[model samples]
Target: MSIKKEILKTIGDLLMEKLKNLPDGLPDLMWFDKQMGQFVPPETDDTAGGTPEAGISLPLPAVLMEYEPFAWQTTGGNTQKGSGNLKFTIYCEHLADSFPGSPVRDLALQHFDFVAAVHQVLQGLQIENVMSPLTRVLDEEDLAPDGVVFSVISYNTTIFDHSTSRTRNHVMVTNPGLEVKYKEESSRPVPAVEIPAFLT
Candidate 1:
């Protein structure tokens, strides 16, 4: 896989792992698809190649709102650096005691709990050869009629690109006073040259 893709996958995988570790645990939500290499939401029943039951349950707890990436300017080097946003829409359910026309303290607290959990898990997250993670809470809103509260949190992670060229080059350097050896089947030329004093 390309460096960019790998980096994105690493970030998604980490989130999935953290969610899995949650006490109540995460359901089968369409957070990220490894095969698609993007944040694709689960399809609704009305959509092609999708079952109605799935779409009904989807967008359940968490949905990735955006996975926007941008290039980063570094001091100087061949390595490429970048940053991306992973925005999530977390759904919180109203409490059993919560009633209509009254303050939804239960729902509010539940939403905050989910936000805190995500924040604790994502901060300072590290992947090999990549910068540690940084995250912030964007905002929250209550979706009426459905009785579901939504909160948005954006996670920022550093990306490093070390992609290399596909072409291959063979180099042979012969030092002074060293004899070049070749196999019987080899037809490659052997070029002799003087060796630097420091190298010798």
Candidate 2:
């Protein structure tokens, strides 16, 4: 598979494995595909003062959002290996449980714990022999319309830069000759024979 596809596949699989056992009867693992514009979370109308349905079965609390390839550089002259920066976003809702008035410290702790869990899952992650150390970018909090908090993490991972090496392989074939070796018991001596230019 291509480097980008491989990287994403590895991350998606890893995250699913780590977060498979979330408590609170949260929704199953969900993915937000940027190209497809799918997997919008429930309670999205909350920002518009519309209360989410009380008993509606919404999608999972955790979602894998879009990833951006920010920067890339060649590790050496070879195109086989390089490094690049990939920013990934993960959104989760119900960060804290509210009382009659407001949320308690447990909410904050839950959010912190989720972030720590994701960090632990991504640290020193390897995909297809490429190593990545996931680092969080301390950007301003991005709350979705449904009140889901989004976290941006940067993955600076090694990539296999695929490039056609036609320029390196093309060479001028000028002279072609065949070298022959004979044993001592051979009856005939080795002779030089002219080879066709096209054979070069």
Encode model 2's per-residue lDDT on 14-45: one tens digit a residue: 77777767675434455432322233334363
| Residue 23, candidate 2: alpha-carbon lDDT | 71
lDDT of 1 by residue, 60-122 (tens): 455444455665755234456777765555555544345555575454355566666766766
lDDT of all predictions: 0.54, 0.54
TM-scores, all candidates, are 0.52, 0.54
Model 1, stretches more than 4 Å misplaced?
20-55, 74-77, 94-108, 142-145, 164-200
Number of the top TM-score candidate: 2
lDDT of 2: 0.54
Clashes counted in candidate 1 amount to 0
Candidate 1 residue-wise lDDT at 196 = 75
